[model samples]
Target: MDEFEKSSIEGRVIELADSSRREVEQEANEAKAEQQRYIAELLKNSSKTPIVVSAVLTSDHQSIRPDVLQKYLDATILQASSFSQLCEQADLLNVKLIQHGMAENVSQSLDSRGILRLPVIKRHYPSLVYESQAISGELAVIDVISRLNILPIKRFTAKTGTNIGNGEGDGYLQFQLRNMFGGGEQLKLDITKGTKTHSSYLLDYGQPVTPWWMLNSMLFKNSRQFGNNNSIDMLIRGFRTSLRSGFQEAGAINHELFYEAEWRTSKLLSLHASDTLLFQAGDDIKSSLGHTLAVDRRNNPIAPTSGSFLKITNELALGKYWKSQVEFSQNNSWLKDDFIGSCCTFRSGYIANLNSSKKTVNTYDKFHNGGANDIRSFQIMGLGPKDLYDSIGGDAFISYGVSLFSRLPIKKWSHSNFRLHWFFNGGKLINHNNAPLKSVVTQLANQHSTSVGFGILLRHQVARFELNFTLPLTVHSGDAMRKGFQYGIGVSFL
Candidate 1:
């Protein structure tokens, strides 16, 4: 061969006249596109097709009895427009079913030795398919996952705290059982001990009456020591039942209707207790029906920067007595973010003993005023009438407070849970024994004690603490005063 003809070709090319690589690739892509379009059409048509969800058949479960599961299934109405919709409904039903099963007291996966004998879910859901449609257009199959092994439906918690400034400590232990009988019922027991509250024991039981309502019953016994202001000890044991509306969100209005029966005893803690306090000491029984309505919208309850709160309560006791109380507070932020804020609060209460034979109301049922929680410069229950050295409480009272709050100036501490607080408080407490209601109200408005203070405030999870320098601006003869620095710690404050 000639040199030109013999020159080696580095690459070889094979070409078919009927087909090329580009054409082949384009054909393959077109086939894939057609297949996808067909699939899309099928899915669209299937989604619009009618389907019937005639029944929901849950798998066998050992923890929840068959009859109980059946009742839950029967209560639910099943309807669906398409297979996908049917699946959605089945999912919701499955969730409820699992919850009901888990609430049962029986253990499904545990054996005698406490070892897992089977898969938790498999034990609860014996069959993978929860519901199967029959004799209809396209049948839908839904699988529900159920957990047979669950944590015990009970819990125990302990809370402890101390106020080193006051040399006081408190602790609480609570035990709760959830769904005790598999009907969404709960039982709780609380035991408390502290320096101020000598001791307390309570048993509470509650159950959901509706999605937005609950029924609760409680038995409680408490012993509390009133310090210098009263120098008395009080014991109250009571049984109360109430129906409460769920106020799960801010700004929601809530109502509570309750009936309470209490046995109360007042005893002197000091040998020099006042004659009025001694006269009020003894056993008393009260039966009352009451209602409480509240609307709260605070952004943060611990240290509110915005919104308002209002609560009104009324009680009727012994077919002869009437008591009413109202409380309100409004808070607003004056500067951007949480740098500064202001709050206004008002509280008033009245008790009337309408018995034609009796002139005095129960001491424990009367209103007591003056405290770090209320008027900062006064001792607890100190602003009311006093017999010798003890505050005898009052039949009618009115209190109001105005407060300004700001964050620390340092950049590093500006966002901390510490606040500078300035406040003005004023109130009056009237005994008004056998006095007309109108006269008592007039006295409550005309005679009062006033105080002003500034303090450092610390907001804690369980309580708010304050170190304040308080000055009594105005005071009556019997109103106890605490000038200069005062320390306070409590869950509620004005």
Candidate 2:
């Protein structure tokens, strides 16, 4: 059996029968009638015989040709052969080294229910063709894959952005649509204009677990001086539509179920003084029904390095307000393949103002914390319960943060995603005038507060920029005291 050991055992028997096929998903006339009954039973008893062909490249590389491939083979062209009975008659015609790209277009799967349009994915798989050619290999290609699964790529889109903060200036516009009538349903539109110089809105509620948009664009040049009320002007409009399905997926974490309908309208490019006492009393309309149950086994969402990300979001709005959110984060490696590690984040949530527990809980959905990303040195929501310096958000809340990342021992910033850590952040946001979670976990240990710091986490490209200089070292004097430097911000590390 020499001819390179019969072409390496007929290319390892068409790679163990395409890795034991069956990832179930076929229909473009059942994958063109199973590639025409497996090439008509491999040319039913030697139809014009001479078989000895080979090709490769599809372990993510994808591509195969071997010259027009005898238009789908009935057999002829011959060259060299130690033919081990043509690899046992191409393994009883179950051969499938699939990978054809409609002239470099792109796609080999991702049709899902729209009915197989499979085409793209082919770059380099055309070598070893000893005896191959003679054609009649009959290929209808499922009526050209059923006219490429009804090819219509619907459309709509608009987007705009201009933002500058600190002194204040913001602008935004957006619109989107996707496969609307073809089952993939999606639509979105948004408009916004903004300016604010913090006249109490809990300094715009700080980090309840990261994402304050660069301290809201890192304070856009700090611009606070407009007029009546003192500088906070804004307008917003939104619309949402979404559809995604596929859950369980036979294991190894990849679940999804997102269905949403939202309409929001918030206006106040006028009134201020933190909207007097809730909207100063004007326009408000919110209608919502949302659900998100996401569990992703993250390897690197920007710079995670390891895995674990959990999300549980629930929003229900019929009359005025309802909120539910729980996010979990995890990361590892204290030198497993040595990339420096340790990370755990837990974000809790709550928002209840179903009209009267005396009416509140909507500063566009209140949840606040100290700045730079959940209590780094306090100031945004400035650590709860206060009415003079503002931050009056509470209806039941809890936040927690844990960090221990390292590897800036300086080796030219030791392989990026930059780090250096030591952190502990505990939280409690309350105003549950009807306490009881064991008296809110015993007034959450004196309305809980914790801080221990040493920071520097630059890593951008999806966010995480911090510069903390904390020191609240267990205090009790009326709480809200953020001694020195604090400008933290984090994102999606969940």
Candidate 3:
């Protein structure tokens, strides 16, 4: 009985071995077929055959004329070594077309693929060089065809919002012209008006001179009214030209070199305006060249959960006035279960009348500390020396702030663009009095105002809003401090 069982098991084992052998043979055949396909593709792309583009065709589009399309193709598809390279050039041509506003969508036509595979007699393609007998043959000459669809080259947009932080309303109308002169040049016009910003008109032009750089020019006129403690109105008309690195926020550093010429006029809106301000009130002309360098790696510019940002600026005006500013902020999140995080920021600036003939820097060029957009619990332009009701602007200033934030506890509100934040802020602004910059910084560090607050933060695509209930922890005499609920809004926040 044992011998009989052994024979049966041997038979079962033989049958299983046969099945495994067949499976192995099938896989080997499949792999061989795949290898052949890869070799064919490699050979097809490795060919050094010269291919002449016989003709180029594009889909009919109303916005772009046929001659314009032909001109672009003539410039880009002038030469290609192989069909693969031809396809690559064609793809790049599509990109160029889209960039120049000739079309938004450009794709190789299926007919081009068909033509590549078509069997042709020598008479049909007398100048064409092709290896038709080879398993991996390449075509030498071919007509390229593509489909292109047009896109509008102009746009108009309007934006309006209530300034919950400043108790005001603001709105703007924007008009944009794209690809002006068929060269990816753009012109934009903005008309803006607000309660605090009385009115502004801007005409901006930009050209992408290269992939990495942009040239920009702006003509602008602005009128602003400071209604609170400053009680002053300012008007500015300016023209600016700049070469800037492309706008990108994802851990990229950007730079700008600019020249600006402006006419500035200041008028006192209140009869009781300070004598310091009164002396500064008048029309002045300024011409300056400046450079700005910035590094932004923040997850969100409006309300970052992580990463950091930094910016530095320097300017020389009329060759006798100099200014420099540095701003830095960082955000971090330690809790994994919730969006609990902290943000810290520091800002400082210096301006000097390098001209020995002048005694003071222009107020328009000086730096001011404290605002809804800057250090909290203090009025706009509220820090530093005071003359009457005016915060008589400082020639140098430094400010810093820290905040801790968390998402709302409610599960439904976890993904909302709202969070609770507690903050501590402090800063000082002072005239340098011909002192060394290090000594001035030391003075700022020793003598500063501070405030602590808790606030609800609302993040928006256009701006961030904060409503904080604040208390001044340390006060400086003559500083304008806000003691209760304060609403703040603008692009940058501490």
Candidate 4:
């Protein structure tokens, strides 16, 4: 062989070996990087995958006892697919949690084994410092919440707002305090004071709707002015105070049940005349234990365009008199073209006095129908019964109100909150005492009051105002009928 050929072959063989070695080293490095990524992802959901390790909950300065949390969580935490799944389990398991107690996903921290440390998961809970208070059972966590500094025991707040209406304009001041402690248990106190210019029994019409002739005439004081028409105005002032406490009964996805104790007292500070006209009134002190169930799936509470709302409250007053009241209301709506929202509200209530107390249920509380907040066809409390010039109210009452809303005809105001609604109302109030059974059932139903009306529903962010004109189709003899136009302005609708 020639010397030049032999030298060239050896150099080519060396170059080939170097090239192969470089390729092998690069492949090994890439494989290692890929394996680390796989290991990291596997750690993220190790509890859900083939790995089945019991969740070890840990905390910082917060003293969280795993033994207590696991008692309520049972074995669900072991099977949770991810941190989010674990949180879902915690929410449903009747455990106490701080305001922003769960936010661990953002911190991609790791332990010695490159696995997510349970302590880092718990660090997401920033506000709470947990302590064990109960001596026995899983419910001991509730005791921990009582001593939690994250939630305060009491807070006082006051609000002053303009209370405007079709016939009355007034300002109100209300003070409230709500205390939250110990596993959703709560205590609330409320005080309200307001003044209004009102008509007979706080139902009928008042100025400035009252014509000038009726106000200036000498007969204004003596004529049936207050009765025939609610033109004679009277200044009224009242103060009310209420206290409520509730124990956590149960909580589900969108519903909650509260077992509550309620005490309420109201005093009429001043009134115009207490003679034969404003006859039936006295002090009332009512104490009640009740269960209130609220299920809210509404898309919007301000102006619900869709979804549903249900509230059922049943109370029993236990004392010298055993009086019970049950109230149920359902609100539902549908939006057409995502803008035209139509809604219907159905509410029915019943009250009965079981004992023979001089201060019967009728003496203090009655079903007052027909108002912007209720039927909207007549004046407040003007639909059912009348005791001479006053609406004395009734024991058992049922009302059905259905309303339909659509865009205004004007193009410029088509999407504005100032819109139009048509409604139909039908209901009856029954006083079972001194009344025929047939009348309470079917006979009065023949005279069941019904009215159809149209109104302007002016909606704002905080309130709703309405102007209505109603025509009664079926009016009973005693019903304070509104023959022509009726005006109502309030925050809610029938």
Candidate 3 stretches with Cα past 4 Å from truth are 1-154, 158-164, 227-231, 247-251, 268-270
Report model 4's TM-score to 2 decimal places: 0.53
- How well is each residue in 159-272 modelled by candidate 2, as lDDT tens digits? 788655223456766665543342223345444456553221111111101110111100111223222333333333333333333222122343233323333333344434
Tens digit of per-residue lDDT, candidate 4, span 1-494:
68889999999999999999999999999999999989767657542321112434343312323343344335333444344444444343322222112111111121222233244233222223347653322111100100111223233456767655644555544443322222222222323333333321111111111100010000011111232234233333232222322222232223222222222222333354333234433333444555456555555556767666666666666653333333333444445544566676666666655564454553335567776677656666777666555565776677777778777878788878887878888888766653454555563355578899887877777777777788787877777666556666544566
Better of 1 and 2 by TM-score: 1
What are the lDDT figures for the candidates, one per model?
0.72, 0.49, 0.75, 0.48
- TM-scores vs. true structure, each candidate: 0.67, 0.26, 0.69, 0.53
What candidate 2 gets wrong by more than 4 Å, as runs, is: 1-131, 134-290, 299-305, 308-312, 324-334, 337-339, 344-358, 361-383, 386-402, 405-422, 426-450, 453-494
Ranking by lDDT: 3, 1, 2, 4
Off by over 4 Å in 4: 1-159, 174-194, 197-285, 319-336, 356-359, 409-413, 434-439, 483-492
Every candidate's CA RMSD: 15.5, 23.1, 12.8, 18.5
lDDT of 1 by residue, 239-296 (tens): 9999988644457899999999999898877777776677778887889999999998
Best by lDDT: 3
Estimate the TM-score for candidate 1.
Answer: 0.67
* lDDT against true structure, model 1: 0.72
Better of 1 and 4 by lDDT: 1
| Model 3: per-residue Cα lDDT over 265-374, one tens digit each | 99988877777767878888889999999999987777678889999999999755788999999989876644898989999888876874665676667788877778
